[model samples]
Target: MTVLTEPGVDAAASAPVLPAGPSQNARARRGAPSWAWLGLVPFAAYVILFLVVPTVLSVGSGFFTEDGTFTWGDVAALGDPVVVQTFANSAGLSLLTAVVGAIVGALVCYALLGMNPEGAVRSTVDAAAGVLAQFGGVMLAFAFIATIGIQGVVTVFLQDALGIDIYAGGTWLYELPGLVLPYIYFQIPLMVITFMPALAALKPQWAEANLTLGGTRASFWLRIGIPVLAPSFLASLLLLFANAFSSYATAAALASQGSQIVPLQIRTALTSETVLGRENLAGALALGMIAVVGVVMALSSLIQRRAARWQS
Candidate 1:
């Protein structure tokens, strides 16, 4: 069909069509919802000034040096053992946190199975978990310190009242194992929170059905519960891992500089710049972090889809 004879085209052709002139276009642009456009100015300003500008500068600056001289050394410098070790360690930690958190969270979810935990338990769990989970960086570190730091409440109580010394008892908060204590502390509650919904989704009827079919609690859990909750469990686990991996202040505050998490190294590089003015190292590290977060979310999505299938 010709454009002139096309049904909708012919119908519109009958109506008087207005033409735009330069003056009208200018006026239109000027009158165009000034407040709406004005409101966006601040947001746009932030995006341009901070996010876009900084990203561009970082990318551009990565190819330069502290003296504004161009060089390929910065990009090539990522091959350093320090960088490699940090990446490997962070990756391992991320995976470890994910697995540990997932298992713990799943168990917590399972334990609360078939219970009517609606009111106080639910609210308290939610509020407390929210507090602990959202409690990031320095605040979280301080909270742990208050609870378990040398002069912390638990430490003081153990030392004075029970004549016990956790520090002397080999609780090296500066060590990796000791590092996991706080990680686990936050992670256990996190796991319970992550798996609580999926666990509660396990109906008593399913258990009853299994038992009627001659399956014991252990067998039912093994066969039915495990398979059904696995995806959601994995999703939550990946989330925990990602969160723990990207974390900095909590680990820094709890451990020694020798413990050196990736984020901490990034911060140190940004602040000190003694490591070859390696803020691009920070950017490269950030890009890696973004990639990890994407992978975790994607895995979570995959697991969620699988869980949906299992439920079906």
Candidate 2:
């Protein structure tokens, strides 16, 4: 049926209906507001001033000689036997602490999981983990000394009470064994803090389903729990490794004899009274440490992505 219509009615209907506002894609492409960008200013300034500047200076100094000329001499020193051994010692110490911490911390997390989430025990452990994770440096060293050192409370009590000497085999606590104890002291708490969230993310529905399907508890863990948790576990291990690898003050205070690990070596290179031309050497050693930490963190991030997929 033909009917009279308003002028431009056909044109209006035929024309494309453009959006009343910008498309989401367009708005997203336009990015955040200017004021929102200001939020990053403080973080950027912090990285620039503290991390980036120091890292660049260290790396740049590694390539320069004592005479201020570009040279590979300092880099070459990194290949020396002593330097190689120091790196080995650091790697071994980090590995030992990471493994020990991961195992013990995982056990502790499992114990906590069985308890009421809001219980006093869980809350106290969480609070203690938070504080102990940050307890390091000279203070941590002193605490260990006061508790287990030659004339420490425990040492004296054992000596008088049982006539047994912990230092009978010599002062091993002032060596690698000693350093391992302190490193693990902090690493275990740090591991708990880093790993507990992932452990808590396990869904009960999956376990219920497995049991309903006639799967035993051991089988469920073998097939589901371990597979789901492996990434998070490895990531936590890498974090522990990096934490131990970079620690200095505790080792410095305990191992007062010489540079037993890379950090101590770097400290000696930078601060030795008789040493000359070692400033650049310190930079080279620091660069090596940076490379190790960078690799560890990179692997950690990749594993965390895998872990996130399961948790999500």
Identify the leading candidate in terms of lDDT: 2
Clashes of each: 1, 0
Alpha-carbon error at 279 in model 2, in Å? 1.4
What's model 2's TM-score?
0.91
In terms of TM-score, the best-performing candidate is 2
Q: What tens-digit string does per-residue lDDT give for candidate 1 at 152-225?
A: 99989998999989888675766565557667667767878777877777778998999899999899879988
Error of 2 at 203 (Å): 0.8
Stretches off by above 4 angstroms in model 2 are 1-19, 22-33
Checking candidate 1 for backbone clashes, the offending pairs are: 105-191
Candidate 2 CA-lDDT value = 0.92
| Cα deviation of 156, candidate 1, in Å | 3.4
**Colliding residue pairs in candidate 2:** none
